[model samples]
Target: MGLKKDYAALADQDRERIQRWSVLDEGEQAAILGDLISSPEMEALVDEALAANPDLQQTLLTLRIRQVQYRKTFGDRLPEIKGGYTAGKEEDTDPSYTGSLSIGWEVDLWRKLADESRAAGKDAAQQQALYQSARDTLGAEVMKAWLELIATQKNITIEKKRLGVLEKNEAFILGRYKNGLGTLEDLDSARTRTASSRASLEEYRENLARQRRALNSLLGREAGPALTLPADYPTVVPPLISLPAQTLKRRPDLKAAYLAIEAESLRASAAYKALLPSIDLEAAFEDVADTPGAALLTDPVWSVLAGLTAPLYQGGKLRAAAEISGMETAKAYQAYRETLLDAVNEVEDAVGQEQALKKQVRHINTALASARSNRLQYREKYRAGLAGMLDLLNVQEQTYDLEQQLNNLIHERLVNRIDLGLALGLGVKQ
Candidate 1:
């Protein structure tokens, strides 16, 4: 099938998966949305990436070649057939014509060809798994970038608010100074804080633009139309249960590793079987006309021959090659184990991150609440002439700082939650 048709089918599958997402429980939501990489909306991005990523396209092409190789393996055991016609004329002789047909085939007495076919098939599957791994990783990164961009936009708003409050405080300080109730030092500090807020706001804007370019690149498009970020962010963290370790086994990278071992083992088997004898069956038929030194006759003739050859001394090279394949299979097995362990470690780390970030977010929330209340009090005190300009500006700065910090912590918690889902292999169906 064409990649276009395949991409459409994949997009439809994503839509179906997402359609079922709304009615699911939180845990199921995590499982389902995680596969969609945190949201149904991401389906478009992933679909575009799948169709446009050069690396992914290259993998699909390689898989196609491997499929051809697989078919050729079976073909190897089938008889090869050929047909030919030739004509020749000597100085004083009529032209002689000959036609021939031939067949040659190898009988797979040791099933080596079958083993090789299995190995080739496994290699193709391994490529598929690797492609999936790359796709999942690309999806996760795009999701993260989108989330961060949203968070940064929110931070920009906060900074703008801070700037507004600072402007108001500066005005109040100016009025107080005119009445000899504020010091020069207070005015200077107010100006400095206002400048800082403006700079931070611009910085956030710059980061936001950079992130959009990144997201566009992932979507296989140039930056033109602005990407939309969802107003609601995900916060529901799913607990890892229900044979989480088994999930690791199904991870695409791990699947690739396991398939590598299988392929290698099949190759090793084929290599071992190579030490056995091989048999070739050959048959040929020819039609002849006019011979110089023999009876000239227009006749058709046929003959068949069976040939067998046993492997003699190859100076132990074949044995060494088999041993190399065996060792590679062993290495692949160990690599699979390592991949599984790393997946487990990532899950644990994400869980740990969720625990710590939630606590930190909670604390920041409390702190943000306190800062707002304190800012209100300071505002009222300055208005009532009970507090100076310095106190009001100081509280506003504190509130501003806390708001930025709180935004960062919450964003981190959400991103880490996404990471946990990814680490658990929740981004793809088993």
Candidate 2:
């Protein structure tokens, strides 16, 4: 028990949140999740999730590593310097001493280093875009769970109210049976109807628990209390909709795929550059003295040489590497195309759902109103013996079904609204 907390604290100390939710103790997880559920809005919870998600943080760390790689490749442009001292006592000579300095620079006559650095920098940018994409997706999922939890809560309330009505009617039917005004079948049907309502209420409660657990998981904690959403939380579909300009710029995943292409192209160019001869300028100085302590080498005793190295033979490995890089660049383009298509599909589907759900809500609201009215008339008819037990039960079931469907429609409209925002690439920053 103590070890779990110790491990969680240790993981929290890491620069990158690499540990999974398993690191958290069950009680600690519940406490943290309860606070998120108590918040006024899901935005705060979404921010916490994105900030605390270990996978997202690891992606950022990976980005930083790529930046370091860029620096190392660019640093190759700087000169390489070394120095050494030698002292020895020979049998035929006094203490002999020597000091030396050497410098070598590639001069980079062709921009090979620059190309490699550019590729590395672009990869870092791509990872950055991917991280933002993850943030956008996480926020959308949180909102969706919030919507489901709210709808389930409302449905439970509705079910309880309906249960109250059924139980009250059952009591009235029992009194009528005692007076010989209603048949045994009618009394039994009322009791059966009340029992069904109870069962429905239990089902709603179970679903509510499931939704709460899902919300907690997104917050990277154990399941906790049910979260209540505000009444005004975007359930109605918006009237205005417009196609965004330069849509590709909005999606981070698409941008990352595009950056991959350019980065790979630069890398391919650098690979070809590797096949050419490399020219380096070398300079060195040496000094000798009779004593162990010798003066350092100076310009007065120095030599310089311009060296060239050509890849004369490598069993075609160099050529193969260059070819592989070119193929990777081509593959990047295909990935970019695939990502673009997926982005387009997501946007269209979100838009379609928003449109369809908005119309469905209005139509369902009308049907629900009619169902409520019809059920009221049937209840009265059954009490007076004009309607049969089966007829009353059928009407009651229909009314309950309509009420539940209405709840689902409202939730769907709200969820689709959130999905549209994510599909348009809003709410996430890179």
Candidate 3:
């Protein structure tokens, strides 16, 4: 439990203990999401999923259950009251009516009840944080799927245009072979490339269909028609803004982890307090009358009682229970630390990936410009009969490949920006 205490202090350095938890409503949540997804359609889709998604709804239900459980635990601190009524006739006694009432309570001399109640409260708070985390994660997931669908559509377009170019070149090669200006080998190679390009276009189409289905599922619907989108990808990608380390506390997963540590610590305290002696007080009243109305209005007897209970011998079970709770507390602390480390690593990795992908896209753009210029020169040489058909085709293939590569890199950079925003805890909570 010493480790648990130490980790709790580390967690507290970033933020105060979670007591009363609240989440931003959909409107406010949308504002946070705009940082990563600015499209109105995407925003609307996220809102739809938040409202209709079954998994998210389940998490919310679990949070409410936890809240109810906390209230039950809190009720344990109050006195318990019971009432009973009876009517009977014995062989040697007159018909009688009776009523009894009793009240009992355990005095929390060692704050054991308080500890257990607080622990239950913390459990509820932990679930609330987890619910928010699920929500934030769902929003990011929907946006990622939308981004994938857009990129896939654009990729299919690039492949279709490429197929068109290959088919045009294949026809030119056939004409050259018919006139004895090109070898049969050159004609066959051109046809092979054209066929491969056509196959690739089909593959891209299949991928597009699958991506649409995935996005449809996220929208809480069965697969249907392809979603409508703009003819082009958005030109604007959100900037990579830096955030302070403390921003990690805003992440609901981290908040849940922190709450778990506190909850376990409180449970451990309550378990150890169970070893101490406890005091219980009880009071009862009972009345017997020949008539029901007399029983209700008059009491014939009254009694009061107090009891002290101590665990003198229980096969060391109480001590073992306390020890187990302590170990669990320590385990909870370790989990929190692990989560904290992962959060930091995720942020660093996303930032590094964004920077790396940007450099790659820049370098690819430069290479594409050079390759396109080389294709132009090769085309000129072929027209003057200075370069063979194979040489011209090879350069053309290289230029087309570079164009596709550039398209992929640009899409990848955009996706990385989404990851970066999520890592920095943007849109998670306010």
For each candidate, give its TM-score against the true structure: 0.84, 0.81, 0.91
Residue pairs in clash, model 3: none
List residue ranges in candidate 1 displaced over 4 A: 1-26, 29-31, 34-40, 234-240, 290-299, 384-388, 428-430
Give the alpha carbon lDDT tens digit for every residue of 1-430 in model 2: 0011222122223312222111101111111112223344776777767777666677778878888887887787789899988887879878867888899899776788888888888988898888778777877687788778878888887788789878887888789889988789878888888998899899989988877877787887665555656654442333223234434566688778878877888888888888988999999888887754545553227899998988999999988998888888777777776776676666678777766776898998898899889988998997687987668777877887788888888788767656655655565433
lDDT of 3 at 272: 90
lDDT of 3 at 205: 85
Error of 2 at 335 (Å): 0.8
Query: Best TM-score goes to which candidate?
Result: 3
The most accurate candidate by lDDT is 3
The Cα local distance difference test for each model comes to: 0.74, 0.71, 0.79
Q: For candidate 3, lDDT tens digit of each residue in 54-153?
A: 8989999999999999999999999999999999998998999998889999999999999999999999999999998888888888877777777777
Question: 193, model 3: CA deviation in Å?
Answer: 1.0
Ranking according to lDDT, highest score first = 3, 1, 2
lDDT of 2 at 26: 12
